[model samples]
Target: MWNYNFYIYITTNPTKTVLYVGVTNDLSRRIQEHTENKGNKNSFAGKYYCHNLIYYEHFNDINYAIEREKEIKKWSRKKKNLLIESFNPDWRFLNNEINQE
Candidate 1:
């Protein structure tokens, strides 16, 4: 079965200090690009070294994904922490997890 398009991602550094929110249909490719830093230096994810995949949610509809991305973008740091904590309580670096899978 094909995976559905999705958004609602939270990426961070190995230190878990920098965080980035984005929407992308191709999760694996997007994460790879971020980790490789293959984009403009001015970009938040590139500049902040937020390539670790800490959290993500899949959505079949692009509109819903976009809406959720915007909603997360507008949130405060505290709110974002809470959201991440829901899935990753220890704030672990998820890059290795993905790679091992």
Candidate 2:
């Protein structure tokens, strides 16, 4: 059987002012798309320039990934920030550090 990977990820603006929660199988490409979409007001991520990845969770199933994404999306910013801090204490931008293999 073929193996697949899915991710529930959180991204923020350069100033760390906003968070965008999403799920994707192709994380690097999706982040690139968000970066490309920056400043376009039609989309929330674009309007807020939320392309800097800060946190992520891996899942083997798309349904679970989507569920987790929805759960995170529902979180208050304060709760989300605490979650991110638990995973990423400094809230460092993690765009280039993962999925390189």
Candidate 3:
């Protein structure tokens, strides 16, 4: 059996005014879907231009990924920004990082 890694990701707009959190087993594809606006407009990410990935955490367990996503969604903007800064000080779009890898 193949094991897929799961991810809890946070994406923001170019100005970093909007934030969207989600969990997915296929991080790359999910990010692509968000950028393509393939998700429903009712979604926070889809409603806003929150396709620039700013931070992400990987997990082998789906439940853990979901739990982390929930926790992140509940965080205040400041807290979220801090989390992103810890890993991405410049808040660079992670799409390029993904593509490079």
For model 1, how does the per-residue alpha-carbon lDDT over 43-92 read when each residue is reduced to its tens digit? 88887788888888889988899999999999999999999999899887
62, model 2: CA deviation in Å? Answer: 0.4
The sequence of per-residue lDDT tens digits that candidate 3 reaches over residues 1-101 is 66779989989877889888889888888888888883457777877878899899999889899989999889999999899999999999998787565
For residue 68, model 2's alpha carbon misses the true position, in angstroms, by 0.6
**Position 61, candidate 2: lDDT:** 88
* Candidate 2 clashing pairs, residues 3+ apart or interchain: none
* Stretch of 10 with least lDDT, candidate 1: 92-101
| Clash numbers, per candidate | 0, 0, 0
Global lDDT of each model? Answer: 0.83, 0.92, 0.86
Q: Which pairs in model 3 have colliding backbones?
A: none
Question: Best by TM-score, which number?
Answer: 2
Model 1: how far residue 33 lies from native, Å = 0.3
Task: Find the candidate with the highest lDDT and give its number.
Answer: 2
